[model samples]
Target: MPPKFGTSGLRGLVTELTDALVARHVRAFLAACPHGGALHVGRDLRASSPRIAAAVAAAARGVGVEVVDCGAVPTPALALASTGAGAAAVMVTGSHIPDDRNGLKFYTPSGEITKADEAAILAALDAEAAPAPAEGALREDAGCGARYVARYVEAFGTDALDGLRIGVYQHSSVARDMLVDLVERLGGTAVPIERAAGFVPVDTEAVAPETRAALPGWAAEHRLDAVISTDGDADRPMVADAAGRIVPGDVLGPLTARLLRAAIVATPVSSNTLVERMQPGFELRRTRIGSPYVIAAMAEALDADPAAAVVGYEANGGFLLGFEAPAPAGALAPLMTRDAVLPILAPLAAARAAGIGLEELAAALPARFTAADRLQEVPTDRSAALIAALTDDPEARAAFFDTGAAEAGLDLTDGLRLAFENGEVVHLRPSGNAPECRCYVEAASAERAEALLAAHLQRLRDRLG
Candidate 1:
């Protein structure tokens, strides 16, 4: 009964996002769908995801909905099964969250839920949703995984990566072997770090600080192009340069967007640095944040212009749906989830075609760098109040003009954003995808950017408090 609809989907701590809660979500979702003959359920490698998926499966089957358990597969695979099977799907994934967190996202045949449907689902959840008696038995589906790998092979053929040495950091990541297989099939030399069978908490951005220090040396020793890895779900990507510094998602996204000529449908929380450097007519549309927002926008765009939109990705470096044009191998349909493998392979292909390296191309993108951080005083309940108060404040209004610049505009589509003269800007918004109240800042330099962000964050935090 909290907000069932965030930018992406309903997500919360495992404490509240329990099996009972997900049961309610599943019941409401099935009730909303028109032709729910079969429901596809998949989960990530998260410790809690399997449990949640079981609950969701039981809940759906309890309502007479046939269930196809796709097992531990990427979200894209689950989504593809739903769309391919012409069935409703629910993914039990916490995607990139710290342990102790989990979430469930629903798809109604089209790979995503509409805002209208989202509101309805929340309303339904607020009311009691008793589990109905089992209408159908749950069955395991093994075909989804093979179909998933086939989709990737079709999109990115093995011709491009004939011989390149790559090392996939094999922490407890699900995609560790998937990536290795993809690389091998693509004819790349893949070296995987030995992985344990247990769960590994990997934060795309919260990469181990030691990895930072070791990255460059490792790249030099191994002579690698990039350190490609994913969070637990394999939905979001985290890349390290040959020197081993984690490339921020904001930076990685546009690179992939530009490479694929991706007419991006992204959220405004992402930095506009890519906008400044992109080629003329590099199409982009900003949604709020999360895959659902971007996915909904892409659906609309595809409806309008089908072939022109090659791919859709996000600033979080989640390469959403993409089209794998006809290859020598076969026809490839893009997956509808935020995929880690695509971003890795796509940009590397770009660098290869351009006769450059990932690091060098990264250097040329743009000067602007944006960072996402939460103001300590601003919590979930207070974020909305802050954005509303700041946007309507008389003093804040006057202060805006004081920074005075001609030919600049305001962008609050997702957050309280004010674009300034020198590309120095501030964004105060709630993390629609997560709990924290986020404030973003981009400036001419790192020091100035941090300072400006800190000052602005302090003022908002004080005000919110």
Candidate 2:
């Protein structure tokens, strides 16, 4: 398929994202959105990014929009800089997808473009507009990277992570070096490991089996208190505890929210249900999957209670701040976009201050575990058909689950989520960016959650593949 807007951004294969197509999208975005004279552009380390970024700059410049090239930086950092300047921004990255694929994330001065904004851009794609009187000037933003690093250090305190040995699994994330800098600047000893020479598609939501198996060994070899990394674009976080066990994003989301003392939290339905049990006092809003939906919910929460401290996070571990809240060292400004650094640093800092290990801090929460995996190369049509069958027909659901127990309830918020009488849950949804069907399961224990996910995914493969 040609590059089209998915749950997060415009995504498709690299071959389909030609210069002409990329330029058209950029022009369409500029025409549809209101912004200042300047637009900021940033990219990831993928081989295809530089070319796409150049196309984006050219297209904006052609329209009289001054281009501020932010170079290779995290997606959130680009958003922070552009929004700070009261300008729109574009990030050239495929996020967690494979390198053969690339995409563009658009942001207005406010934050990530909402679903309404996506429709506006599509409607403006074919509309004619006069060219600028002259080409706009191009400039480099050399300070955005440092400014991003300073944001966390200043708010969370320079010694927030004192006496902690943190391992940074650099891989090929564009924020690899930046992550190390943040850790060291916060008084933690950062041991960089497994730095890759080229791009690595690290999906925080569904980490590769090999990487999961290697985390423990890395921890043992280095005596690490924890290991942290991010996806290609550095918006989603991946964290492993002291024993080298990877922590689920849902777990991290609630923990970080609690640490931030969030009064109102907005999270996708795919996140762990334990949030309600752990933080009953906080007003919670359950939204459909995707950052756009969560951000919208945060906005609604703020509207209902203007004094509330609003926060948003996804099961993928990307945290969004909806208000300027108090941190241990200072006040943090609102950044209503998916961010990896805050979630990663906040939890680590809390654990350090509490005089406990990351694992201990997690153990204090309600024990609800979640596991997710995907069946790749499964077409969206097939996935929709299967879920429709199960959703509409009781016989189909009974035959598929084979649990011999009635469902406690069913939620069609974003996908087909079935809650069983035994308190187990199975949720299936088609991947928004690629040809894949994602499955998520939850249970009282990690082993049960994992087994449920494995069995259901195998069933999907048998039926769809």
Q: Estimate each model's TM-score.
A: 0.86, 0.98
Q: Give the number of the best model, judged by lDDT.
A: 2
Model 2 per-residue lDDT tens digits across residues 1-465:
567898879999999999999999999999999768889999999999999999999999998999999999999999999999999999999998888999999999989999999999999999886769999889999998899999999999989999999999999999999999999999999999999988898989889999999999999999999999999999999999999988888888888888778988899889998888984557789999999999999988888887779999998999999888788899899999999998898889999999999999888999988999899877788998999989999888878874346889999998899999988899999988788899988898989888888889889988998
Number of the top TM-score candidate: 2
Quick one: how many clashes does candidate 1 have? Answer: 4
> Local distance difference test, per candidate?
0.70, 0.91
Q: What is the C-alpha RMSD of each candidate to the true structure, in Å?
A: 3.6, 1.0
lDDT of 1 by residue, 248-279 (tens): 67777777666555554453445556564666
Candidate 2 weakest ten by summed lDDT: 398-407
Give residue 150's lDDT in candidate 1 (0 to 100): 70
